[model samples]
Target: MLEFKVNSQSQSVDVDPTTPLLWVLRDNLGLTGTKFGCGMAQCGACTVHMDGMPMRSCSLPVSVVAGKQITTIEGLQSKTAQAVQKAWVDLDVVQCGYCQSGQIMSAVALLESKPKPSDEDIDQAMGGNICRCATYVRIRAAIHAAAAQLSA
Candidate 1:
């Protein structure tokens, strides 16, 4: 039995240690907020916070995260997350919306790490997250707006 705390909930699943955290979160736990884009870590669609750091869940094995605190979009309650979410909504940063959750998660992590991230910081942190709808401009704007909200 592999166990981990997800979204602040203590949960356990009977699965292979090698199973990707994506499938476990989606199939086993039914937390569908984390989407699977590219199975590789490049896409960042499955991004989730492991111990408050953004990580790609699609490629990470469940075993590696055992006993770690995993926070998904649904469980994000930090001030940064709230500010990012508000900025996302206020900026209308979603196109098709498939990638917005990951974008928001990544933005939340960025804001937490650098409350006032510059363009370079936003680009570096969000570079791995690909938006099929090409919402990069809006995403960056939202991140900045979130920082502003946080600073105030």
Candidate 2:
């Protein structure tokens, strides 16, 4: 049995330690907001925050996250997260909406780490996440808008 805190709640699962955290969150925990894109973690579609740092859940083993604080898009409650969500909505950042969760997760993490990120900072932080709809421009704008909202 492996134990971890997800969305501020204690959770325990009996499964292979090597099971990717994405499956654990989706199949076991029923938290489907974190999407699975590329199983190899290059796409960043399954990003989650482990101890407040953005991590690709699809490639991360559940065992490695035991006893850690894991926050999925469903459980994001921080001010930064709220700002990002609002900015996303205000900017109409969602195209296909499949990758928005991961994008929001990464955006929240970036804003948390750098409240006022530059375009370069946003690019560097969000480089790993791939949006099939090509909404990078809107995503960037939303991040900046979120930063502005947070600062106000």
Candidate 3:
């Protein structure tokens, strides 16, 4: 049995220790917003916040994250997350929308850590997330917009 806090809720699961947190969140907990893009963590589609820091859930073992605070896209309730979401919507940042959740998660992490991230900082922070629709321009715009909104 493993015990952890997911989205501010206490959760316990009896499963393989090495099971990736993505499966546990999607299959066991019904939190499917954290997508599975690349199982190898090359893509950031499975990004989620572990203890307020962005982490790739697809490659993280559930046992390793036990007792940690996990926050998925579905549970993103921070003011920064709200700003990011609003900015994404305002700028229409999503194309295919398959990877927006992860993008937003990464963006939120970036903004939380660095309130005013430069282009290089955004690029370095969001370098791993792959979007097939090539909406990188809009994503960066939205992050900047969100930062502006937060500053207000």
Give the Å error, residue 45, model 1. 0.7
Model 3: per-residue lDDT, tens digit, 30-131?
A: 999999998999889999999999999999999998899999999999999999999999998888899988999999999999999999999999999999
Instruction: Estimate every model's Cα lDDT from 0 to 1.
Output: 0.93, 0.95, 0.95
Q: For candidate 3, what is the lDDT?
A: 0.95
lDDT per residue as tens, model 1, 1-152: 98889999999999999999999999999999999999999888999999999999999999999999999999999888889989889989888998888888899988888889999999999999999999899999999998998899
Residue pairs in candidate 2 whose N, alpha carbon or C atoms collide under 3 angstroms: none
Off by over 4 Å in 1: none
TM, every model: 0.98, 0.99, 0.99
The ten-residue window of minimal lDDT in model 2 covers 95-104
